[model samples]
Each structure stands twice: as structure tokens, then as C-alpha cells.
Target: MIDRRGFLRLGAVGGGAVFMSGLYGKAMAAAGYEDFYFVQLSDSHWGYKGPANPEAQNTLRRAVESVNALAVQPDFIVFTGDLTHTTDDAAERRRRMGEFKQIVGGLKVKDVHFLAGEHDASLDNGAAFHEFFGPSNYSFDHKGVHFIAVDNVSDPGARIGEAQLAWLKADLDKQAKDARIVVLTHRPLFDLAPKWDWATRDGEQAMALLMPYSNVTVFYGHIHQENHHMSGHIAHHAAKSLIFPLPAPGSQDKRTPLPWDPAAPGKGLGFREVEAEAKPVAYQITEFPAMKG
Candidate 1:
């Protein structure tokens, strides 16, 4: 349902990348807003050790350096999910989480946000993740936009669950019908590829709750590549992973990381910048390599 005008891929400007939607333009126009932008880095899988990415230990650090190199730093930065690789050992999990935090600490921007991916949360119901980061699901406001971070990974079944659904409903009830809304989650609310664990089990209910709001955009990760989709008037954009990329939805028999291309080491791994303009209600998304040439 992605409106034809909802997404415009403005690829690689001055060695960066960006995206914008028609809906964002309209919402900004109605909100009496000020221009602002944020950085989104997803699926770093910080503790991973594998051939999929030989330089796993340095990828996240490179990403941080890339952001630090931005001519104008974003107001804030957010890691959508998979901040760490999964571990059955509880102590090891905590250690990875701690180390991951310390690495991202190099960012020039002090205001950073986090969300949980299944690898970081599904094992112990987000206990380790919560211990390092704060609550997984919450809301905040900036420059006339309402942002909600929903925790679907915490439930193990990939469900937002009934309790959080009530919370979402209550939160939405407080906003104006035209409030500009941004949803950040680890999984797609719509059924992108159910067998691959890409869709939230009860995401439709969550979408129903958000549908009444006229201005809404969703940013997510878990797919490990840049994907754009529309759910009615709402636009969902998936971010690129800092670790490795996966095959496009259902393009292959199995959901596995694409082999790392030694010839192009950083090919499928990167981060993005979202710049929002107030006067015209426009936005531009710019992407950067996790490791620069």
C-alpha cells in the first residue's frame, strides 16, 4: 500500500544517501514544524563471529566513525535492533551488551536511542537488554513529531502482546488525530515474510490502533536491507544492517545472510540519515557505508 508519492529514494549525494515520502511532506506542513533529522543504524550484531562478515569486530566501530564524520551531526541517533549477537550464556550476553554500548559511545551525538532485536531479547525476554538499556518500548517527541518504539521481540513469539497493546492504545489516545507519528520497531507490522519471522504476530492490532492517526511513518530493521512498503497511507522503511545483508523477501529458498563479497567488502552493510524539513513538510534519507573507502 505504499503510496506512489510516499517514497523517493535520493541515492548517494556527496557520498551519502537519503529518502522522503509525500506523506511526510504533508504532515510537516500541518504541524508548524522545524527542520530536523536523525541517524538510523541497524542489525550491527555486535558480538557475532563468522565468515559472513570477517571484520565483525570492527564494523560497528567503523559505523560510529562514519557518523562522527557527518558534516552536521544528527540531532540524535537510534539503533533499530540486533545490537548484539545472540548468546545462550547469560553472562556472555551481558558482556556483549556492555561492550556494544561502549563502542557506540564514540558517537558525536549524545542523544542515542536503542531497541531490541530477537537476538538481543528473545532468549531471556529482554532481561539483559533492559539491564543495559532502559525500557524497550517507549515514546518521545521532537520538533512536532511523535515517536514510538514498540517492543515486539521481547515476547519470544514476536508479539507485541496484550499488555503493550493497551499501552499503545492509551498512548495514541493522548495525541491529536493529525499528530505526526513515527513508529520504530524491529519487525514489520504487516506480514512481510511470515515463515522468516519478519512479521509481528499481533501487528495488525497495533496497526489498527495507529490507523486513526493521519500522519504516520514506520522505521524498522530485521530484514537487513533497505525495503520500502506501504500499509494504507503509512510508509514502512527498513534500514540496512551494519553486519550483513540477506536475500530479498522470498527470493530464495532459505533466509540466510548473503556471502560477503571480498571484492566489495562493505557492499551490503551501511547506515542511513533521515532529514526532515518543516516549512514544506519534506524529508530526505541519506545512507553511508559502515566502512568508508
Candidate 2:
């Protein structure tokens, strides 16, 4: 059952209320009875140094601090992608990744999962990213949930390709019919915006691979904002960035980073907290800047 109070707080933001409330209620109600709770934080862009966010250096630190400070520590943390900004120098990339590690160094948690974004992978097709992080795509089983991480950013176009698809099928075949499945990627499976190359080229194939599952949820990053759409029984969700926000699809003729409003500088760094087990629970997204201000 949805938490009426929490849903109302999330709904006050506008169109996001219904979806946000529904997800929270559904996840929370299944918490202890179903699965574990985990937090997703994306697009930290650790190397991004700019005045748009004066506290850029400390922003990530603060965000990690907030996560650590949570009364209920999540089972794990998933950083969807964009660990660093685009860079040609290998040393620079290493430095950025190192900084990210430093920020989360004190966190009292276990199991951190990472995915690579186009910015982090496109430069050299994830050569540096993989060296620091592990395999670009992989899967693991926790409790009754089958978690699949797909690599869409490091290629000619955003695609899972044939090798990964085959692995996905073989992996799914091993799980039971009632098992819950969750997929993580840097790009949405649907054509969110073809012009910006935001949509994945082989996403349809990836979706087909997952269609056989009874319960599935796909989580992505890259749009730097939150969006939810239902395709069949599968729920697709995009997370907010820890660095900056982007204009909604078609909201602007050309996509560009939105300027930080002086009155709401830290607004973009907010994130969603999800408990995805059997009975899931999530908090009303607390906008850090708004709350701190």
C-alpha cells in the first residue's frame, strides 16, 4: 500500500506525483516480505569544475554524506554512470575516478555497483572506464532477484550487441519463473530522443530478451532527470543526476545543460531512494538545496 503522507509530498512537484507515489507505495509495501533496499546515484561528473555549481568539488562529498547519514542504510549503492566528465587524458580520468572513491571512502556500506555513461566510455570506448571499474556489462543474483547490467554507451551506437544479448538469454533461462528481474544501463531501452542519439539502437532486442520475465524493472541514467514509463509489465525509470539537470526531451530545440538557478543551485544533485525487494519502500525525494536553503 502507498504511504499517503509520503506520496502527497512527492506529488506536490506536479506530473511526477502519480508515478512517484505508486512506485514508493508498491516498493515499500513489499519491503520485508519481498527484497532488499538499495539506493541509486548517477551522473556525479566528478571532474566537472565550474561556477554553475560553486560547490562542485564538495557536492559529491555532501551527497555521499547524506546517503551515509540515512537512518536506514541501503543494502548497496548503484552509480548508474558518468563517473567523470569527457576527457582525453588517461591520467585525468584516473584522477576523477580516484576522487569519486575518496568521497565515498568513509561510507559505512558494502557492495557498490557501477555502470559507464557515454561521456565516460565514448572517448576511447570505455578503455579507461573498464580499467578503473570492472566489466562494462555483467549480472548477479541477490536473494530472488536477477540483476543484469548492460553496456550501451561504449560502441558505434548505444547497443547491447549480440554477445551481451546471448548472455542475457542464458542468464534469464537459469532463473525461476517467479524470480524478479532488474536491468541497469546508461541509456533507456526506448527511443527517448533519436536526434541526440539518446535512444539505444538495439534496445528493442534487449527488451525482447527481457519480455519473457514476469516482473522486470529497467533503470537508466544519462538524461540527468527523472522519468518513468511503463512498457508492458516492465517499469522503466530514469534517475536524477548528482551534478546537473538537463532540459526535458523536446523542451529545447537543442539539448544543453540547464543553468543552475542561484536560488536553487543544488537542485540537480537530488536522487531517488528505492527499496526493491519483495516489499519495497522509497522516500519522498528530498531536494537537497531546497531543504538546506
213-277 per-residue lDDT for model 1 (tens digits): 87888999999999989999988999999999999998888999999899998988888888765
How many clashing residue pairs, candidate 1?
8
By lDDT, who's the top model here?
A: 1
Give the runs in model 1 whose Cα sits over 4 Å from its true position. 1-11, 24-32
Error of 1 at 148 (Å): 0.3
C-alpha TM-scores of all predictions: 0.93, 0.84
Native-referenced Cα lDDT, model 1: 0.87
Number of backbone-clashing residue pairs for each candidate, in the order shown: 8, 12
**TM-score of decoy 1:** 0.93
